[model samples]
Target chain A: MDSIIFLRPTRGLAALNLRDLWVYRELVYFLMWRDLKVRYKQTLLGASWAILQPVVQMVIFTLLFGGVANLSSEGVPYPVFNFTALLPWGLFSKALSDAGRALVNNRNMITKVYFPRLVIPVSSVLAGLVDFAIAFGVLVLIIIYYHFAPGANFDFHFTPALLTLPLFLILALVSALGFSLWLSAMNVIYRDVGHVLPFLTQIWFFITPIVYSSSEISSKWQWLYALNPMTGVIEGFRWAILGTQSTPALLLIISTLVAVVVLISGLFYFRRMERSFADEI
Target chain B: MDDIAIRVENISKSYRIGTAPERYRTLRDSITNAGRHILAARHLAARLSAGRSDLARSPDPSSHSTIWALKDVSFDVRRGQVLGIVGRNGAGKSTLLKILSRVTEPSTGQAEIHGRVGSLLEVGTGFHPELTGRENIYLNGAILGMKRVEIERKFDEIVEFSEVGQFIDTPVKRYSSGMYLRLAFAVAAHLEPEILVVDEVLAVGDAEFQRKCLGKMSDVAQAGRTVLFVSHNMSAILRLTEETLVLEKGRLAYRAATPEAVDYYMAAGFSDAGERLWQASEVPADAAPFQPLALRVRDPKGRVVDTARSTEPLSIEVEYRLDQPITGLRVGIYLLTMRGEYVFTSFDTDDPGKFEQHSTRPAGHYVSRCTLPANWLNEGRYVLAVNASAFHVKRYFWDDHALAFNVDATGAPGKHWPEPRLGPVRPALDWMIETL
Candidate 1:
């Protein structure tokens, strides 16, 4: 008997087609490659801009917050302290914004052709990893420079905690993908999402711990801070790289739970709205 | 094994029309609309609720804003059958293709396919200008649902067919539009799917390229694959498919062999051989002051005809109604070849005397006629587009390509040539051949 495929309008909450996604994995890879390639095209600085962005932000933060405000960095040098957190934060924010606009940016494909719609946002998020890797190299240079700087009290210690770095990075990715899934789907229907995204990301940045450590927050408010998924991710990066704080098991657990919930709900919301994308877009 | 390749069962798609283009309804709009409906129907709430099912089937009688793009459309294609769909603009042709391609879902029913479907709904779809020709080939191939290995296998053939090997590594931004479309078409054509669905993407490219595409399509059809094609070019449709479907106002009007189906589609809405009378409902509300009543084509004997002999004078009459006196109103007819090349535009007031006589027309029904002298038109199908407007003030009403008729060259001056002449008009002129 011939294999048959039946298509019907999805009603209620629809499940993700993991098998179809698996079949189209190559397409996802190519889309990510296209995004990465197009991002740097025709620019003189090219990929160097990726590394330069976080470095520039770190310099400004050190001058404004570290020096002016005398913010505590858990006894570590402010530049090194802020750079570690910035790496994960930078990845999170960039991935989130890029993935959020992915669907609208590929409007031609969305309207003219058909593929697993999830591939678009997923590939945009994945493409930001290349920039993250570049920026991470700059962070490593800063660490090595401070370790040997004269009169510097900083110590370079490699810990087993560094093994958990991948865990924190994956956590950041999941949260970014989660928010992007919702934003991208919403953006197709309501362009207001596009107009409001930049402000939302900026507000989210202030709430997350990048320049200042979470220790600065009052102990009473730590639980509420953990509700922001990036808090655990940024703090975990600091803990893993600088070995400053002990494992915040509670923060990690709570943030991980929130990230998982957001990711799952975002997936379902995206699938529910996927059917109308071609028409609305 | 199942012999059927595609089965569409009672599929229908409806859309809310005449609404703001902003498809995403904001919360405030939805709330206000709901509140307004509730307030207006408070006393009839119970009765309305009871008739909800019937109401859903047909939109509110007072609000004529909903349009069913496709209604209860059902058809089946056996393996290796080539089916063609023909319709006027907004006749639900594109909607049907979108549903079958799974780009959008139908409001009711479903479609089943026994094989993988590849659709080329638009040419050069998803081709980034910054990308090189080679990169874009893979990108477009992937967009058309081709796998990486499959693209790699056919990469050489695609390049050779496109004839852009010299610039394959250069960015498509630097290539001319023709070159870009060639590469795009080549990649799409090489997508060897079991079921191929194509829209009017072949309308691009030069005449030579169009011929090449037509040949390629015929080859695909002859290879025993199921193909569904939609095109405005009836010649291509007649050449490629054996069976055709005609859609009229979101419903299936006729389904038969290609030639017969094309005849039915071309003759749709016409009451007589060469005359069309517009119903009041068919006219949009915006064209209120100048309402088109009827359009007819007649021979010199004043007899309405669908086919005109090129040896005789032919006349076209546009009958319209004016509800109020209008100044500077000119009724004109645009003659064009079936392929959409404009031959000329003639207005009733082109003559200074006529313009002075009827500068302002009073409220009444009137007929504006234009006559084409004998042996002036070529033997081919022609389209008549009617326009009523005041020079630069405003366009009261305009219907582009409103009517179609045929001109036969059986007794035309070109009968001695025994070859087809190109262009829309074939004017017979005085010739004096010298003995030089």
Candidate 2:
């Protein structure tokens, strides 16, 4: 028997069994592809829903937060700034909801056949990325529109830090997947987990600096705010694409650590609870 | 030993079932229980060390806690084998399959399946009613671990087998039940996984479709692949598989050849034997006039019995409490084979002279016997579920679980069992081995 390894501050966190996941990667890809096709199959807009989600949200944030609330867009245009952050954030939100209920939603599959239970949530997270890419295309178009097509002072240019955008996106993916694993496993046993997910997401949005700039927050509470994990991801995106000076470096470091902690613990909790899912669901 | 495609070590799964409280517990109860398991563990240990039994007790007290499913189970299946799992409902057959598929992990032990697995636990699994048949086919195939290329290669065959044709592009919600079952089974069967796990979803299809599926499963098994099939249909189990495992109430009750295992499963009656004969809460007051007061199946001596050879004289004795004497009454015993096949019906009207006027005061019991001559039934597990009607079938009483019995084979096995082979009648036959 292998030695017990705990992945959390609290004891009894089960092993993640990473080797099994590696073996089932092909299955994981197929499941993700299946989810992507089915999600868009009969929808009226097809893939357009992806571009529309963040684009609509960007318009709302630019009007409400930038206009009435006077939230700073740093030196960048509010539309471009909000769209970039919302692109990844929207993907994270979709992943959270989809992965959170993947097990319960597929009750027939869960009770009848056997496959790695982890595959369900992981595939949900992966499938949401396709939507993120579609939304990202819209963000680029909006950036060009504001910078060059109109009478605007903004100059669109790529920087070396643009490469880190993928890393930040990866961080957000892990963060959503981590929380989703816990939610999906819990949703199988207690349906209330699903009922509370929307409220949870609403509160989580406030904690992440998705709407207002993180620069407005005082430094004393930066470490605490960074505990939200998504803080680092959103701030990093605004910094990379919008070229914001106040990137909240200290908050990004602390939130990265926090995200890692939540992810590892979430995965362990999920894997431990996974064994009973089929029976109970 | 041949390649062990699947190895199941001793595994047990238990569910902690808690009744819904009359009212949700207050925050105080939550804090108390959480504190006991976490915050008080060290203090409770100290209290135990100090010899204070009451203070040292653990908390999170659960009322009437019981395990709802599964006990130690172990088995192995070689490559290129089709193993049938047969049991009544709630017998843990599905639970075992879920464990093997790793959709759920075993509670106590481990199961190692060596190859890719594709499972069809029920018809239309992983299908969204809003999704077209074509979309569902891909979703189900992916869920079964099949790549797009693999599904593409078998796509035409699947469509042909299901006979969905133009309807394949339509959402499955509009499809008939037969079409839904066909498409679901076709995707699962054609997925080309090394190991195929199927439940009794095919039984939902039409007779011709069910036959086609059974034939396909036979072909798959013959191609040196592994299969784990779970079904309540004994004939399907016996026809498609060589090895069988029987589970009863989450435990491995028996395992052997297909026929013997199915026989054991059938012999174990479906109803819970421990339940009381009469439940006041279960009986409906609306069934007052035609209530089933008593039920019994017996031999000539009137002793209750449930097993007999095909040639033995047998009878079903149904005793009913009639509120009033009624004429033109029809008392019939429906003979159903274990596979739910209706063999034949025997009614009192078959013998016109058997009816006689007999009255009793107020409410009283009456016995109606259904007698069958020797060698009438085929050799199989038969149930004597009975029903009665009055006033030319105006209305009556029906008891689904009246009684069930098994009819053993009295015939010989045509030199297979080293005994004299009897004819289909199971009665004395004259020999004809003369000058010819």
Candidate 3:
């Protein structure tokens, strides 16, 4: 009653149909809500898994790097340093793995009705924010523990840099969304892409400087190192939260460019593959 | 043009089955196939340069790789009209609906809709097992393109209709399959779009629930909305639809008033080989002594055919050769409807005196036949199973589905009635209205 709809066979380079996404925004919200509700269902510990996964990893890394390897945490305690990086890393990594399976997982909805297929992976990537938010609370508690603990060697102050946290958080989200789009769409055609995701994320984790400081790397390779989008996000996130040395502005620009390019290209690739999803799925 | 709700123009779809199909294709297979394609293309190029006539004249490789599930189908639905789609399996009914609903893009041509279209290719499409019944209602409503506030307004009606109000807060995975179907159809029925395209969703669900759904669909159609219904239930098609389209093998075979279309579609599937000649290999070694020869379906006019009008009598005659003397041999035919539901079984010796005292049979050529009276069978395909045996004696031979035929009951008694007849037989019983 509102408007006419025309459906035609597409040849090449179809538009993203951003209007359909806007109209079906409610379904997106419901799917995201569904994922969040179902994630903790039937679990004895509930949302604690989000907190437990990162905290346990932080303890392991702290004992291995700070005590045995004698790595420098700059001025911050090793636990806070590693935990800060873990928060954004957790967000990115969860977004990757979850979105990789999101299309194949929600194939029931995809083949049955007509909606923007982009909604599935987008909502899947967004659902990780809930887990990240819960895990973030632990980071704040750890920061407080170091601040007020008796005989603590670390100094804690409210720096002006704290205001930059939201910006870096947005960057981390953008990077996750960008990479997730590639994985979820390709996962539809080549199913083995899912098998490779674990190894891909594992290698991606080591290169992002989560457990080690970026200063440990040789200065000559900085440009090549900054090619990784997460390096910018994780480094920027650490600087904002812990008041570590600020990342070079050039490195931040390169990382943001990579994130934006991946996002735009992922959108293009996703739109290209979306028309065949119903048949393939 | 203004009153037209949907206009489909020459739409077609083809699916490319790359290499062979699996649940999902792996990278190793795809990469290797890509390498093979490159080599194949190079070979083709070399052949073309040498002017190989056959290679130059071959059809496009892309066309050979894809199968056209639907081909050049077009139709239009006027506003406020309920149109039914009838087809046998693999007839492309589901494919056409999927195309119009935009579940997949067509390989060619296009369709235009002048109003909002809500298609239910399946019920309970987006329901999650972990979600409670109440939550799934909201999720399913949103998935069907209903606003949250719209679902909130109809929430109680949906719950009441599903009859799961007592267990609304429970997870749907815990609900029985019947309860799940009821809840799923209840949500889909409430989607009040201007054009509703439903695909045989009523085929599941219990009779009471199906009646409820039909009643609701009648309400939807009566409210001046366009509806496209695809179903194998002929009675439902006759009851709800004004016009119908018949598809055969991805092509539009017929379009007419609902009854006429149903008749044409039912009669079109004449199961071939109606007169089956038994070969030596088909018969088992244990029944070597009794050689079943031939079976044929003959119309009332004594002409052989694979299909006949329902109002006409049809006969089944089976011929055979008995190699040796067999005592108490009774050759019979089992008349079954398409789904293996038996209409009746008749033997040459069903008559009490054992067919004029021919109890003991001598070895020679023998023929046994039975005639189904006019106006007896409903319009559908029926399979014939043959048997040769004697009560309390040795079983000689048996052949399941020895032959098949079809019948058309366009003018069966009570044709004016809306409700469906329950069984395979349509008896023309005598009825009269008496003044009290």
Error of 1 at B98 (Å): 0.9
List model 1 lDDT by residue over B1-436, tens digit each: 6789999998888776656654565556657988978876774676687775444433254567767899999999989999999887678999998888778888788899888787878878888888999999988888788889999999999999898999999999999988998999999999977888989977788999999888888888888889999987777888888999999888888999998997777666644368777888777766768889988999999999999989899999999999988899999998866544568999999999999999999999999998999999999888787889999887887776588889999977768889999887788888899997
Worst 10 residues of 3 chain B by lDDT: B55-64
Tell me each candidate's i-RMS in Å.
1.6, 7.2, 1.1
Q: Compose the digit string of candidate 3's lDDT tens values, residues A1-281.
A: 36888988876788988888888889889999999999899999997898899999999999999889979888789999999999999999999999999999988888888888988888888888888898889998999999989877777778888898899899999999999999999999888888999999999999988889888889898778988999998889888888888656766888999999999899999999999999987
Show the lowest summed lDDT stretch of 10 residues, model 1 chain A.
A1-10
| Candidate that beats the other on TM-score, 2 or 3, i.e. the better one | 3
Q: Which residue pairs collide in model 1, if any?
A: none
Model 2 alpha-carbon drift over 4 Å, by segment? A1-13, A38-47, A149-151, B1-9, B21-63, B75-82, B109-118, B191-196, B256-265, B268-334, B337-341, B344-381, B385-402, B405-436
Give the CAPRI rating of model 1.
medium
Best by TM-score: 1
Chain B alone vs. reference chain B, TM-score for every model: 0.72, 0.68, 0.65
Each candidate's lDDT (Cα)?
Answer: 0.86, 0.73, 0.86
Write model 3 residue lDDT over B309-393, tens digit each, in one string.
7788888998999998777788999887643446788899988797658777888998888888898998777777788887777
Residue-level lDDT of model 2, residues B250-344, one tens digit each, is: 88999999878876766565442311144544454555565565556566665666666565676666666667665666667776666545567
Positional deviation of residue A29's Cα in model 3 after best superposition, in angstroms: 1.3
Query: Candidates 1 and 3: which is better by TM-score?
Result: 1
Reference-based TM-score, model 2: 0.75
DockQ of 3: 0.59
lDDT value, residue B116 of candidate 1: 79
